[model samples]
Target: MLKLHDYWRSSAAYRVRIALNLKGLSYESHSHDLRSNAHHDPAYKALNPQGLVPALDIGGHVLTQSSAIMEWLEETCPEPPLLPPAAADRAAVRAMAALIACDIHPLNNLRVLRELKNDWQADETQTKMWAKGWIAEGFTALETLVGQHGKGYSFGSEPTLADCYLVPQVFSAQRFGVSLDPYPNIRAVNERCDDHPAFVRAHPRHQPDADTVDSNH
Candidate 1:
């Protein structure tokens, strides 16, 4: 059986959830409470040295990193391909994914936000602004890409790896009070993703660990 170690409100975990659901894979969910630093527990650390959520145990192998996990699922189960077959198209999708995971998310993740408060003495208002700024910047570029290269989804008429990364980022932005009205294309793609069963099941609120803190956070 497949097992996924995840936290409900984690954007990285949410990406993996969407990929797994998009592939129609069945997995058991083990929820970790970020509020309590459950990710740093010895048991989880052994599975993922980085002590992050969305670790996947599948077919006797354990995988870490949301991007790596999503790629594995795509390579192993190719029916509902998350990336286009064309090399250029694949590159474009990967670029979009990187924009969120590397450029945007790292700066605004829970750990970064907490560090800003503890180390730099940034208040809630400042942290919120930090998150909002990064998200708006990323979304601005993504919106332009969507207008130029997107179809009904991020890349084409069908959902792709880019969409998986995008949905979670949008959700995180909304949680942090970022205004998304400037990115109509991003919101349109998000609305399209919302109608898909895979995206629906992968929603943060649908996870078992979705309590008030997780949902509102």
Candidate 2:
């Protein structure tokens, strides 16, 4: 069986879980509690020098980075494609994915928030505002793009790599209390994903390591 190093609430891991579920591939989950610094353990560090979550152990090799793993899955398991067939459509979907994975998520992720609080001396309110600012900015741009490109899902009728990146970022935006009302297209896509079996299965709340207590970090 495949082994996936994961943390329940990690957005990166969440994206991979969605991809795995969408492809109907099964994997074993290994939880490392980020709150308790378990990701910094020497063993996990040995597995991934960066000590990031969502490392996929596929027999002889381990894959790190959610984007890379999803691409690998697409290459290996091409039955239910995550990308559109047309080259331009594929690039458009990838652009949407990068908007979230690169522009939005990185600015508001746990590590950046921690840096804001610890090093920058930002209070909770300020840190939340910081996250909200970036999320709102990214979503504003994404709304326009999705409005133009999306059919039912982010890129088309079927869920694509764009949706894989989007659902988690939407979750993060909600966690930071970013308002969704202004982005109807994004909201519509999220609503559609809410009913998707793959997305339902990948939700952080359903993970084995999920905590009953809510934590923003």
Candidate 3:
């Protein structure tokens, strides 16, 4: 059986959930309370040296990183494909996914927030602003890409890897008061994607651990 170690509100983990649902794969959910620092526990560290949530223990072969896991899922199970068949189109989708995962999310993740508190002594408001700023900037660029190049979804008419990355970022943007009205194309795609059952089940509010907190998503 597949087991997914995830945090309820983690955008990275949320991406994996969407991918899993898109593939129609059933997995056991293990919720990690990131705020409690459970991911830093020594035993969990043994599973993933990075101590990140959304680690997949598939038949005891551990996998970490959301993008890596999503790609692995696509390769291991190709039905209802999440990526385009052509190599160039696949590269384009990967590029859009990376724009969010690599260029945007890393700068504003939980570790970065912890650093802002511990090292920089930033208050909660300032930390949130930092996150919002980065997200807004990234979304601005993504907005252009989606507006000019997008058909119905981020990369094409069908939901692809880019859509998986985009939806979570949209969730985060709404959380931090990032006004998305400026990005009409992104908002439109997000609305369309959220209508899917896969996206609905992957929502932070619908997660098992979400009841533990008064989640706004």
Candidate 4:
């Protein structure tokens, strides 16, 4: 059986959950409380050297990193493709995914925010501002890209990897109080995804280890 080491609020884990749901794969989720340092446990580190929220144990192999796990799933199970068929189309999807996962998300990850408070002595307000600033910059550009390439979803009429990445970033952004009104197209796509079973089931609040949060976000 496949097992997923997950944190409810983790955006990367959220991406994988969506992918698994889309692929019709069943996985046993092992919840980790990130706020309580459960992710740093030695046993968890053996599975993931980086001690990340998501580490997949499957078929006698432990896979680290969310993107790598998604790619592996894509290769092993090619039923409903998360990536488009065409080379250029796939590249476009990856580019958008990278914009969120690489460019925006890394800057505002939990570790980075924690470091800001612990190492740099940044207050809550400063950390919040930092996160919003980075997300706004990336989201503004993504808005234009989506406006040009999207219809009801981030890449096209159907959900793609771009949508998987986009939804989580929006979740994290809203958690930190980043406004989405500037990107009407993005918001519309987010709304559409919110109604999707794959996205809905993968939402943080829907997880077994979900902590209380404002439902309005």
Weakest 10 consecutive residues of candidate 2 by summed lDDT: 208-217
- Which candidate would rank higher by TM-score, 2 or 3? 2
The models' CA-based lDDT, in order, is 0.91, 0.93, 0.90, 0.91
Instruction: Kindly report which residue stretches of model 4 are placed more than 4 angstroms away from their true locations once superposed.
Output: 213-217
Model 4 lDDT per residue over 1-217, tens place: 7899998889999999999998999999999888888999999988788888788999689998888999999999997998989999999999999999889999999889999999999998999999999999999999999998998999889998899899999999988998899999999999999999999999999998896764421
Candidate 1 has which clashing residue pairs, if any? none
The Cα RMSD of model 2 versus the native structure comes to 0.8
| Best-fitting candidate, scored by TM-score | 2
Quick one: RMSD of model 4? Answer: 1.9
User: Where does model 1 exceed 4 Å of error?
Assistant: 213-217
**Runs with alpha carbons beyond 4 Å of true place in candidate 3:** 212-217
Residues 78-189, candidate 2, lDDT per residue (tens digit)?
A: 9799998999999999999999989999998888899989999999999999989989999999999999999999987999999999999999899988879999999999
- Candidate 3 versus truth, CA RMSD in Å, comes to 1.7
lDDT of 1 at 179: 76
Give the lDDT of residue 202 in candidate 1.
95
Weakest ten-residue segment in model 1 by summed lDDT: 208-217
Tens digits of per-residue lDDT, candidate 3, 1-217, equal 7999998899999999999999999999998899889999999999999898889999859999999999899999998999999998898888889999988899788888889989999988998899888888888889988876689899889889899999998988787778878899999999999799999999999998886557532
Task: Supply candidate 4's per-residue lDDT for 10.
Answer: 90
Error of 3 at 148 (Å): 3.2
